[model samples]
Target: MKIAVLGTGGGARAHIAKLAALGHEVHVGTRDPQATLARTAPDMMGNAPFGQWLADHPGVALHPFGDAAARGELVINGIDGRNAVAALSAVADRLAGKTLIDYAVPYRYDPDLEHPWPTPWGVMPAMEPVDTDSLGEQIQRALPATAVVKSFVTQEQTTVVDPASVAGGDHTMFVAGDDADAKRQTTDLLTAYGWRDVLDLGPLVCARGMEMYAHLHSAIGFGLGQQFGGHFGIKVMR
Candidate 1:
């Protein structure tokens, strides 16, 4: 399976490395392949440069956003939260009819907020379309031809690709989307990633709850004594 991951961030790298290790052809998408490779410093979150990470993982192909999407049978939108819609909209044709597993949250960082929630990284970013709409629905609206599944947002990047790291993978993962087939595809991938429980939260609208949980997710991290982010899991007890 050729999978397209549209971001060079740490979270994206987690998926990229795991996919490659799973024997799939991983096509990593970036704004500019050359610029990404030219980076000598760490990213905003202090993750190593893409070039350095790529060096350790061989045989994974790197290409511009559209090219990577075109090469993939399944597409993963790991683009920056704020820019995901615009970047993905530009490659609409390439992603049409494909199962797009969107894990990006629309986080709006405002420094001049009257009341700011501070975090180890600076300020806790406010999420857009959080209550009424969600990034998943926005992406689905932008690409009507695409089957978009809302997933991986309720997870930390590390635990997303490796669920067993926490409580032996007893926790639950959730998927919400209008297309049943798309949700199934995403659940299949989660199974590949060793997720034991993946709940179908029904339609895409449920993503509002998932996206809003981002704030609480961070708070839980803080409570756990994680300076920046925490590695934990949420289990829905029956």
Candidate 2:
């Protein structure tokens, strides 16, 4: 699969790592493509000089914007909620008829919000309420021709991927989208990345519940330990 990952955050790096591991040709886009490529190279292939490898493999290109978006068979948005729309706006047209996986939430950053600062029990104060529709909806509205599916927001990178490290075998990851084909594409992608049990929670609106799941997980993490990386699964009682 020719995969293009946007943004330069941990979430984007996580997608890049998983996609590259699957033997897919991955193109990464960020504000500083060179710097982002350098940082990700370490996490991607250990001591393999991935940057030079990418440079050597002219077929595999890591570009800034248009090249990355235009060439990808599948596009993934790994940007922060705040910058998600603006960051991906450039490639909206290129995404037409493509399966675009959206992993963005709608968490707002407010200075007036009062939570806890740096303390043993770290806590982020509540800010303005999220749209609940998620940045994905906005992107979908922008690029109507492109199929947008929302999934993987309920995880903390550590848990959604390689769930064996924590607990529960084949942990479940929720998938939501309006388009069937797009949802299938994301489902296949998730399974390839090691998520064995993917729960299709139905239409894109379900994403609102999934986003709130993150907020709840955050609170739970504060109560448990400072570090919060976990996932959820539905257990049906027969």
Candidate 3:
């Protein structure tokens, strides 16, 4: 399948590399393809520059966001939490009539929080639209014609693409969306990614809990004393 991954960050790279290894045509999206290629320094997360990464992976193609989205039969959104809605909304026309699997958490990093969780790299970012609203719902509202499924937000992207590496793949994965078919497609993609315990949390509104898991995910990581999400997984026991 021709897949478009919209973003050039670490999470986006995870999907791009996996999809390409899975023999799918992967197109990456960014605000400016040329500028993205020109990046010399690492990203905020300290992931290597996209150009350096791109040089190693020659099969992938990079384009402006809309153009990349226009070329995909399936679109995986890995855009940063803060900018996902606006960036994707600008390409809404290109995404119409397709299933969009969104794995972005809307995070508002406030350095001035009275009490903030600290990570080795920086303070943990706070979730935005947290309690009542979620980034998934926000994106769905922005692109009514597109079927948006919220998923892969509860864990690190590394664990997402390679679930079996943890606990022999006994863990559970969750997907929530308003459209049933879209959720099914997302599940199919997850199956391709080797997920066996995919739980449909029912409706996009359930995404609130999924997005809220961000904090707990961090808490678990901090508890484990490992940076970068602690390389763990959660299983929903029946």
Candidate 4:
């Protein structure tokens, strides 16, 4: 599959590397390709020198502006929480008829303890509910023609790449999307990226619960010293 990871941060880089490692045609999508290369070149050289050495290798491309948007069969939005909607809007038209893997959380991150995170976990006082009616829903609303599958947001990035190394033994990866075929395709991609256990929580509305898991897990990590070594998982008994 030709996958485009749209963003230029650690998350975006992780997507790029994972796709490359899995033998997918991958592209690093950035508005400023030069800036991404500038920031990434140094780190890739030090931490992943071998991957850096494979810079000239096939199956990976770095694209700027709109070109990256036009090339992908699958577009993964790995941008920051706040910037996801705006950044993705730049290529919304091109995204029509594409299975857009939305890894977004529309939270302000104000550190307010009074709030119950948002809809999906619980409802807001003066606002609407947050499930299929939530932020992911909003993005889907914005791109009606694009098949949006809300996934890859419940667990930490490292956990997604290596479940064995995750603190809580094996974890569950849940997905919510309106399209069954798209969900299945996304599931296959997740499997290739190393997810051993998965749960399909029905429609995209279920993203509310999945997003809430992230908030709760984040709080748990903070309480445990934020060493990036803490995690939470579901246990099912037959």
Candidate 5:
């Protein structure tokens, strides 16, 4: 499978490495490939520099957004939540008739961000389109021809790639999309990553719940004194 992953941060690197390792031809897309490779410092999230990570993974190719999207059989939106639509919009024509796996949460922390350390998990981060719609839905709206599957947004990076490493793979991840074939394809990809419990929440509108779950996810991380560690995941006990 030829996969194009967007973004230059940790999430993009993780996806590129894993998908390439899984024998998929992976290409990473960024606004500017040269600028991305010129990055010398670690990212805001404390992940290694993009240049460094790219050097380690020679099998993955880097290209401009449209070029990558044109070349991919499947596209993964690993870009920041706020920039997803704008970034993908540049490649909208190429993305038509392809499965787009959305893994971004539209939440931004204020500059004066301060967590209450080891107690009640402070206030939730400010998110966009809160009560009315979700980022996933917005992405779908932006690319109506593309099959947008909202997934992999609620877990840590390690958990997204290797679910078995945490909780014995008992936790559940979700897929919400209007297209049944797209959802099935996304499920197969998730299963390849060791995700055992994939629940299709039905229709893209349900993505609002998945996006909002980030609040509870943050609360649990704060309560556990480990911000977004791989030790915890959401499980449906029937």
Candidate 6:
């Protein structure tokens, strides 16, 4: 499988590492490959520089967005939710007839806050109103010919790659898309990452619930004193 993962953040790095470990030909897509490699400082969350990770994983190739998307059999949208559409637009034509696993959530961070703060608990980001439409739906609409599957949005980076890191491995992750084949492919990828309780919530519209759940997810993280520390996940008991 030739997989292209976009972004240089922790989420993208995790996906790249795990997918590469699975023996897929992985290409990392970024806006500026040279700038990304030249970055010496950690990200806003203080995670280690992506350059270090890139150095460690020599098997992964880095390319600009268009080139990476053109070369991939499967494309993972790990870019920031706010800029996902703009970033992917560069490769929109190449995405036709391919499975696009979208992990981008329309999460609006407060510019005033230096880091994501647990405040006004159980509230969704103001910018993305769940009642309207989700980021997944928007992206799907943007690329009508692409099979966009919404997934991995509710998880932390660690748990997205290794679901077993959470207790009992009994928690649930979601898949939502109009295409059955795309959902199945996304599910298989999740399973390969040790996710045992993947639930298909049906159609891309259901992503509304998934995206809205960010509030509760954030509340749980705040209660635990850790925002997605791989120790907790939403579990469906039934």
**Residues 104-147, candidate 2, lDDT per residue (tens digit)?**
77765434534444434344434223455556677788788888
Tens-place lDDT digits, model 3, residues 127-235: 8898889999999999999999999998789889999989998899999999999999999999999999999999999989999998889888878987766588999
Query: 121, model 6: CA deviation in Å?
Result: 13
The global Cα lDDT (0 to 1) of model 3 is 0.92
CA lDDT scores, all candidates in order: 0.93, 0.68, 0.92, 0.69, 0.86, 0.84
Model 2 scores what on Cα lDDT? 0.68
Q: How many residue pairs clash in all the candidates, one count each?
A: 0, 0, 0, 0, 0, 0
- Model 4 scores a C-alpha lDDT of 0.69
Q: How far is 184's C-alpha from truth in model 4 (Å)?
A: 0.4
lDDT of 4 by residue, 1-238 (tens): 8888776555566677677887788876777766555553445213433245347556678786357767988888776666666777777887888888877666554343564544332433222234446667767877888888988787666556555566444667778899988899899888887677778889888877766666566567667766342455554433
Q: How far out, in Å, is residue 98 in model 2?
A: 0.8
Clashes of 3: 0
Better-scoring candidate (TM-score), 1 or 6? 1
Q: Which has the better TM-score: candidate 3, or candidate 6?
A: 3
Model 2: residue 131 alpha-carbon error in angstroms: 5.3
Clashing pairs in 3: none
Q: Give stretches of model 4 more than 4 Å off.
A: 39-59, 110-132, 167-169, 228-232, 236-238
TM-scores, each model vs. reference = 0.98, 0.79, 0.97, 0.77, 0.93, 0.91
After superposition, the stretches of candidate 2 with alpha carbons farther than 4 Å from their true spots are 34-60, 114-132, 228-238
Ranking by lDDT: 1, 3, 5, 6, 4, 2
Pairs that collide in candidate 5 are: none
Error of 5 at 62 (Å): 0.5
Task: Please say which candidate is ahead in TM-score: 2 or 5.
Answer: 5
Model 5 off-target regions past 4 Å?
111-124, 228-230
Q: What's the C-alpha lDDT at position 137 in model 3?
A: 95
Q: What is the lDDT of residue 167 in candidate 1?
A: 98
Best by TM-score: 1
